[model samples]
Target: MERIELPGFQDLRVQFDYDEDTGRIQYRKLSNKARRASSEAGHVADVGGALYRVVAVEYPSGKSRQVYAHRVIWKLMTAQEPPREIDHINGNTQDNRWANMRDGSGGANSKNRAMPKNNTSGACGVVWDKATGFWVARMGLGGVQRTLGYFENKEDAARAARSERLKNGFTERHGLPKSGLDKPQTLEDTLV
Candidate 1:
């Protein structure tokens, strides 16, 4: 995949201190007047059911743009632009720890997603087919949706879906419950 270039990335590096290990970004000495130096730099954005950290960075040209915090950390840690999609290894979107992230393709990232809240069969790709009176298993591989098969038993369908996912390099953590570290208890806890 091609790397995504960020305008004024160098200036952003100068204005923030990114802790690669902890996945925290703090405002540096040249940060905006409203924020104090060494303070935490972003806000949490809940998209779908996932929480991502986003920061509004002001460039030298005086234009402010919002960027994903995980992408910024990837650039800082790798010293190169990151891929368009960043995947969380543990299926917890809010856990930005360096070890839990990877430069992911759309297919690979989709394979690592948490189970949907609306899932009725209690599995990632197994669903009840009302018309057929059978449990159906499906998978998305390399951007193509493929039907594994239909089964009379729900568990059999779920097993088929899981087997296909594993064969296609899906993580074991995928389809598990989604969770993350506790939110900051106080304003000071948000600081570096």
Candidate 2:
């Protein structure tokens, strides 16, 4: 079978009426031969919740294609493909609302992530260095992990980590939350 170029913003414009507020793509009016029209025109027949992909049928050939909703929505709104990843600001995969999405690098996207549930330390990047018996704070900058500072207290270490994260341009949401602040698991956890 021949490969087809992926449908882009201009291509989708003919088949979808995008609602940026809700991130929904509704089927638009089409003539009898339009592929998308094989279903219905009034509302997008298959669109449900925030699905990651949609099957779009071309107007003439009736060719069906799979497109990522977030990418398509970003293209429609911004008129360009994302520079890297399409990240959801609130950490919700299904919430593709226009404001929730942005173009970002892997490092930048990681900075917006919530602290992992498995993290025993209250800080996003701070870990108890058992060998040194100090609360070590570190952060990722431009894909490299850099040590921020070492502190005697977990709070101090967490603060240092937060400060470094902010100074490096990471959003506050990506910083450590309260739960990790005092979760010292090792001997160093108590040393702080």
Candidate 3:
């Protein structure tokens, strides 16, 4: 319930003139001291203890249009806490709303998750290689990549991956089994 000063509103690129008679702000092509260029597009105002960035501008001609800067402001105002990092829950940047947004750590925020499907590569899997000298696992989403790491062995690497997922509460799909590699999957493997 602390009031914070809104930033980046004083210097705007697009010019808007305030109408005293109407008591409403309007866009004007001319620039003046009272009518400085808007650091953002469309219009912005505070409402119900929250600031809302106008998504569209209604021109004198009565045409409505979407503005990017206004949308950015809306997100800034509505975010939980300046959004340490903004995550698009559905993976679309344009869908910026309170429900679709989440605050995340920079590392967690960069996960490039795609729609889950049966044949999705690496969905329920972790990298395993005994002879490669190091073990590595990675997950990607939205052009962002995150790596688990370089373990001494495949088993060690898998354990590390599973531990990380569990700590983060990520559901396990096809990683290592909980019992470790103590029990072989097949009778032949056990005999060997």
Candidate 4:
């Protein structure tokens, strides 16, 4: 069992608890008023409608430091079922509102990203080589590199690449064509 140190009500007091089931530390609040302690400890408490946890420490020279009570409480409350992965919808770590949090697999987590402007090549920005009968996609984030594969046609390769991007929460932006600019001219364009 592991114990977690949480902030206490006042001074350098702290609380401790263990998560026997997962071998993790658990910290909760105490009802009694805190007493001054030599070292820092953590504890949990309720604030408004939310639960919070904190840790406090005092140096030998009598200087003291205190942290908020929300740290441990948020983890324990939200991780009860523990999703494979947790996503913060707005991408903010501190915005732990229940509605802002979602449980999802790694793949699902990736599908929610906004595509970069320069990433124009495969499903998100990939193109297939009709001459070689190979599917190719490129990533421009750090450097340009080709992700290639063999496919029957450009569409097959494009779909596969798009599926991969979608799983990681990456969505195409600015109405970019999913299959790139090489798509065959449609009759609608001729009429226009």
Give the number of the best model, judged by lDDT: 1
RMSD of each: 8.1, 7.9, 15.2, 13.7
Write the residue-wise lDDT of candidate 1 on 2-95 in tens digits.
2335655677677678776777787775446766665677788877557788777666777777777787777777777788788987666667
TM-scores across all candidates? 0.80, 0.67, 0.32, 0.30
Tens-digit per-residue lDDT, 106-188, candidate 3: 64444423223432223233454557756575544345566877766555555555556546544322232223233334422
What's the lDDT for candidate 3? 0.41
Clashes of 4: 31
Error of 2 at 31 (Å): 12
Candidate 2 ranges with C-alpha deviation above 4 Å: 1-5, 29-63, 176-192
TM-score of candidate 2 versus the correct structure, residues matched by position: 0.67
lDDT, residue 123, candidate 3: 23
Off by over 4 Å in 3: 1-71, 74-84, 111-121, 128-166, 169-192
Task: Compare candidates 1 and 2 on lDDT and give the better one.
Answer: 1
Clashing pairs in 2: 122-180, 122-181
lDDT of 3 at 119: 24
When 3 and 4 are scored with TM-score, the better candidate is 3
* Total backbone collisions, model 3: 8
lDDT, candidate 4, at 34: 64
